[model samples]
Target: MGLSWQQGPLGAKAVGQFLTPEPFPERLLFVEPLRRRMRVRLDGQWVADSEDVVLLHEPGRYPVAYFPREDVTGLDEESRTTNHRDLGATAWFTVLEKKHAAWQHTDLPDHAKVLEGRVAFAWRAMDAFYEEDDRIVGHAADPYHRNDIRRTSRHLVVRDGTRTIANTKRPLVLYESGFAPRWYVPRADIDTAALKHVEGETFCPYKGLASYYDIGERKRAAWSYPQAWPEVAAISGWVSFEPDVVDVFLDGRKLVLEPGQGVVSHGIDRGLDPDELQERK
Candidate 1:
């Protein structure tokens, strides 16, 4: 869960409500400058490049970067036209013989006027999206999203009823924005025999691709990032168990899963990045 998606402020289950005289609308959209250079690649060509990109944060959706039309090139407009309830009539564009690889809104209301002359490219359709020299995956990086990792000597233990699943004295605590802190245990401290590898996999924009494990009958009860993003690489190859599905104790205190902390990660069809989460890995 990040700032604008999932249960964050601008998400469907927002933690706070807007203060206004009249009842606020059920949905809220926030637009802000990315303040970084962004570029879009299509079939080995850099199609869009700009330092003046604005990101749109919509409820239940990943934040999207909208680039100034003047900064985009190497793309031609298509005949397809569609209606956008918020932005107005939308026109599609073709990139490298790919139809509808990009789009722009024709007219917008005063509140959304900033998007009138801007365009957004389909993330999966492009070869890659770059911030400076490094590439970004999953979706545009959420400026408000944060990932903090710290090494701790906390006594953490996991169990499935009477069977001890994992015991660890050294753990890394991951404090991600808008979610509960996750405790990742080093492989040396875990019982590898307890984990059963499954067929599913997930990709996190900040973290790397995630592979799940089943503890006996508990499906996807445990997970690990074999190749995590370099920013928070301390937890790479470490294991983490779900508090709601397994018993987890930290510093002798039993842990409980916080409400709204349950994440429903869908397989790629959720419009997740196609290739991988780690740009260089």
Candidate 2:
């Protein structure tokens, strides 16, 4: 019979026969070239440059790569650890292992699969902390979720003087629990002549780098940071847009979402969060 459960040394689930897990090598190189002296801290101990650091790619799990003994910042002989087999490989590393309920994939109900025509892929949001439950639980679109960032696209149609004009527009959505939703639009989608660069950039371990753009007459309209995590780099050209804050058009009409005063901005919310482990766990 096929393997039913593959548990790590510390009792976390490792791999299952039917699960779809990718190798860590599949990630994109860091936008700023990867540093040679890479060391990560695990619960206050340092695990340094050793040849055993192994990198693995995991979806939904943060820190896409799994570092071996040498790559960690704080790991030493004093750390009480165990080594064991979980299916085929030796599950190593003490401070880093998969967390419970953080990794589980059960087959979908057979009938639910038949009603939707055909589903190419099944996607779940990264961890509720990155995207909280108060906002949206999860959604499926096209073939991939990319970096777990939410996105919606529409073509703009407008009435110009006596003539009607049609323009294609795309917008990105960024939301946290109990916070206001922010929309970002591209210069091409809107009237770019009025938008100016704000001179700021932010980094997400899942999405990559982001630069800011502000609406000349309004505030920040759209921004794009070309470099992103290698796994879902396909959405690199896409920019985030604010739906309510900006007078941007979605398809033929302006999008009118329910005005919410309790929108949280951004941060890791553990109370309404999901499991995120950057290590072997």
Candidate 3:
């Protein structure tokens, strides 16, 4: 079992469905103060630095950090546009000729008054975003999303139709917020001959770059973190099967994909760049 959506200050469902209005039936927006020192870099220069930052949590979107206008530098007004659904008037700015690098609310609604005089940098446009010295990857980290990896002796098996792909008694169970527990099997216990390496990859901030494997025409049916982050080193070189793509069993009991585990496309991939890939090391 994973963490429930409503268990945290902000619901995990809201962050997962960031662009949908269904999760926010009340049409409410949340703004709260961020105590950490936040910084933004553009064009090889620090464009913004502030200890007093506010975070806006819009429905179906990751939290965005807004810095005090006075702390930002080298911004030129690019254009003015109406906000989405008339929330307010928005002003766009360019940082060092990077068009639409930042934006701010010029006309605030009663609910979004806290955003006044604050500017938010586009995560994809900026060279880097930081919470103090360490760089932040992907979108802003969701306060509600949590991940835990537990080592278990429970017998687990992965199969594709009648072919057994992996069988292990030592499995690592990864429990992430709003998702089902993913069982990771050790490489030694898996039949490597049954897996074919696939091209392209995906990155996870909490983990690292995930290398995919094909199981007899099942494209990307399994994934492994070859070089995982220090925090989740237990899953390094261990493979986890996509329950929806193949059959997974625990002690001979078949497992099914949970309701919220369906894959949904998101825009965070836009933030991935050569620099960001190189930063993984």
Best by TM-score: 1
How many residue pairs of model 2 clash at the backbone?
Answer: 36
Instruction: Estimate, for each residue in 23-63, the C-alpha lDDT of model 1 and write its tens digit.
Output: 76778788999999999887778989999999998888889
| Model 3: number of backbone collisions | 4
lDDT of 1: 0.85
Pairs of colliding residues, candidate 3: 17-60, 18-60, 18-61, 19-60
User: Which candidate model has the greater TM-score, 1 or 3?
Assistant: 1
Relative to the unseen true structure, what is the C-alpha lDDT of residue 17 in candidate 3, on a scale of 0 to 100? 44
TM per candidate: 0.88, 0.35, 0.86
Report the candidate with higher TM-score, 2 versus 3: 3
Q: What is the Å distance of residue 119 in model 2 from its true position?
A: 40
Superposed by TM-score, candidate 3 places the C-alpha of residue 91 at a distance from the truth, in angstroms, of 1.1
Ranking of all candidate structures by their lDDT, best first: 1, 3, 2
Name the top lDDT candidate. 1
**What's the lDDT for residue 277 in model 1?**
42
- Per-residue CA lDDT of candidate 3, range 1-281, in tens? 12123322244453344466555454456777888898988768999999999877665456788999999998999855658553578989989999888998898877677788999998889877888888877766656566789989999999899988999999999987656689999999999999899987777766777889999978889999887877787898999998778889999999887664664323334445645654656
Cα lDDT tens digits for candidate 2, 165-253:
22444555545222244454444654444446786554333444566666544455455646544554444655554444455455556
